[model samples]
Target: MTATTEINKIINEDNLVYKKTNLLLDNEMHYCPGCTHGVIHKVIAEVIDEMDIQNETIGVSPVGCSVLAYNYIDIDWQEAAHGRAPALATATSRLMPEKYVFTYQGDGDLASIGCAEIIHACNRGENIVVFFVNNAIYGMTGGQMAPTTLEGQVTATTPYGRNTALNGHTMKITEMIALLPGTRYVTRQSAETPAAVRKLKKAVRKAFENTTEKKGLSFIEIVGTCSSGWKLTPTQSNEWMKENMFPFYQLGTLKDE
Candidate 1:
């Protein structure tokens, strides 16, 4: 066999232990190196591909770091106003009852300006999946303090570190969502390690399955890293998230009913 043919044979599907999901487009992702958005996106795409729901899924992404999520994920996408993804997703779910709908949002977009929208959508039992990526600080617009920013964490707006007395306590929105009666499932997860990535993939699959079952709402809070925003290397960002974000956010399911 020719050398190129031999190499191609070795790289064929039967020998391929892993490959990128087709649900993820070839578009180069805009996320910074070490950012967790790309990882989370991959997990979601894999879940949809595994479930064979690519054509039946619609994703909504609002303003924030994930505003361009549609560019990477190969699915029907809707762009909502900043902090309004949940609202748009609610409408989409209602309009297309048979299709799966999901919202990809960031801390600043979901926990800040769009807080009310999410709360109401969950309360109303929207029958959609919500992927809430929390890196604590505002990543896209510049490293600013976000609603989920941890106490004592420094940011562009909080160079002295977040002070509860002045800045207010960080919001544990996932816990709050779990308490809402309209929500059928809510969990906090991360993707800093291989095991963690597996767990995250499972969570993503469950959330999409919930939607398929006509469950009210599935909220997956992915406590992620913002290396550039944190002014840390990817390794440092993962370490810092483990030392800081995990303790406060705490992984595991908050509710599954």
Candidate 2:
């Protein structure tokens, strides 16, 4: 069979998108009020539902707010230790190559504790998908300093604002990962606006496509909001992320191979 024909055989309409089935349960998300985790979770669920991978995929939840995502995704999931989701995903994907394995991690998990894990995963070209959330601060632990936090930003730990001289500088994880040969796809997106969410869905689908092709790593960094951490209402938080962060972080596909 031709490569195109063979690939098409596995992805047909009768089994994709579960419009008839609501995979997510309606439990109250533990994320702080106005946090973007809920929107990101829903986006992932929608993609999973649309792709019809509900029964054939595995998800790894890392530390921070993403740990409880299994409750909402309605799929087989595993929780990785503190910041080991990438390592866990690598092992799982290597063992079950046909099963779509993904990791949902935060800035603290992906850019900090799991730094080596994710970088290795990308360098090794593991056929895994990573849903990275960069909300600037460490939201789950009452808003502390994070690797992605912008300069002059105030958090519980950075009471006087982040100082380049003292705290170093914020790291751009997505752009850094894009430089790795292991990554077949890399993109930066946000959930601040409906228009942005629509664009994010396309990136999410491409990440899964990379996996189906057994290409390499797929990394998508989402600029999310932390209302509780930022001391702003939900609406205000979203606006702030757009105004102050989006220009620096921007949003778009970095590469596709």
Candidate 3:
């Protein structure tokens, strides 16, 4: 056989172990190399595809590094104002109670300016999924100090390292949300390794399953990386995240009901 024929023969479904989900578009991603957004996006798409809910799913992505999420996911999407994705998602979920609705938000947008929006939405027990990607610092906005920035961590705004007295303690938003009565499922996950990615995928699938059952709000916090903002290579960023971020944010399910 010719080289092209041999390649095509090996690429058939019978031989293929894995492939990109159809729910994810073929467009080139714009996220910085090594950023966890792409991996998270893939996991979401895979869940939606596996559940065969692509047509019944809608995503809301607000201003942040994830603002362009709509460009990659094939499902219908709505762009919300900075920190307003939860509000928009709430409305969407209420208006179309049969459809699965979710919001993709970044730390700066969700933990900072969008704090009130998320709290109220969760407090009301809105039947929606909230994907909170917490990279600690503000990744899209010049690496500024964010609400979740680690104490004594350096950022553009905190060149001298974050001082507990001067900058307030790091916000553990996930834990705070877990305590709310409205949240039926709350978990913190990461996507750094093959095993970690599998866990993250399982968490997302569970969240979507909850949506199908009309359960209360499901919150998934992905403790992720921001290599560009952190000024480190992708490998180094992963190591740094496991060393620093995991100790504070931790991982695994915080609440399930």
Computed on alpha carbons, the lDDT of every model, listed in order, comes to 0.89, 0.87, 0.91
Model 1 CA RMSD to the hidden true structure, in angstroms: 6.3
Ranking by TM-score: 3, 1, 2
lDDT of 1 by residue, 74-184 (tens): 788889999999999989999999999999999999999999999999999899999999999999988999999999999999999999999999999999999999999
- Give the range of the ten consecutive residues with the poorest summed lDDT in model 2: 1-10
What TM-score does candidate 3 get on C-alpha atoms? 0.91
For candidate 1, the clash count comes to 0
Cα miss at 90, model 3 (Å)? 0.9
Q: Residue 15 in candidate 1 has what lDDT?
A: 64
Using lDDT as the measure, the top candidate is 3
Q: What tens-digit string does per-residue lDDT give for candidate 2 at 64-116?
A: 88788887777788899988999999999998999999999999888999999
Candidate 1 — worst ten consecutive residues by lDDT sum? Answer: 1-10
Counting clashing residue pairs in each candidate, in order, gives 0, 1, 0
Model 3: number of backbone collisions: 0
